[model samples]
Target: MAVKLATAMALFAVGITTGCQGMSEQATNADSKLDLAVSQALAEKDFRLYYTTGRRPVVPGFEQLAFKELEAQCGVKAMPGTGDTLRSEADKKARSEAYQYAREFNIKMYEACLNRR
Candidate 1:
């Protein structure tokens, strides 16, 4: 699963570069495709577009909205992570594991929200 996600992320990064180069042509030719791409990218938590365009990719309050809606449907909050509020990493390996687990939970919640839509 990690390998597949890494591959997808690589491809998306490449696409972002190419897409920006021909911005005008792509905008005219692929408006609908662009819309769908944006939808799936958000659903799948792919934020390479933001990196390439220097734009804020997600809508304001998106996380809060998702938390509320998913809680209503799933009877639990979709947010994960330890919050790491302390800003201290006592163990590097443990922190890495926690980050990986949080990423997986994010993907799962993204898919669930997409299905609900």
Candidate 2:
């Protein structure tokens, strides 16, 4: 009976290892997708800044600076408080869309990692 139980455990382990052969590629792909999303965000921010003030968004540290301070922190490139603009609203919407995509992809990534056992 003990030998039978050990055999079952060994077979289960081998089955699990065999099942996870493709998991690494899936995770790398998801990480790549996430990186692309971040790049897109950076590009959109750059374009918006250029369209409004002909400059790119500035970051003092690893953290980001807010849009309101752009006029002051970014010098003349960030002048004239535009108040609220159509593009600002559109940009917010687009960012929300990106967030949703990231969330979905991250969930899949999590599931893939969990199943790798």
Judged by lDDT, which candidate is best? 1
| Predicted candidate 2 versus true structure: per-residue lDDT over 8-112, tens digit per residue | 999999988877867877667767876675456344542122112224433222115464553343221222332233377776675444444434533443333
Looking at model 1, the pairs that clash are none
Query: lDDT for each of the candidates?
Result: 0.47, 0.45
Model 1, position 71, has a per-residue lDDT of 40
Alpha carbon lDDT of residue 51, candidate 1? 8
lDDT of 2: 0.45
Q: Runs in model 1 with CA error above 4 Å?
A: 1-66, 77-84, 91-96, 112-117
User: Could you tell me which 10 consecutive residues in candidate 1 have the lowest summed lDDT?
Assistant: 49-58
lDDT of 2 at 5: 100
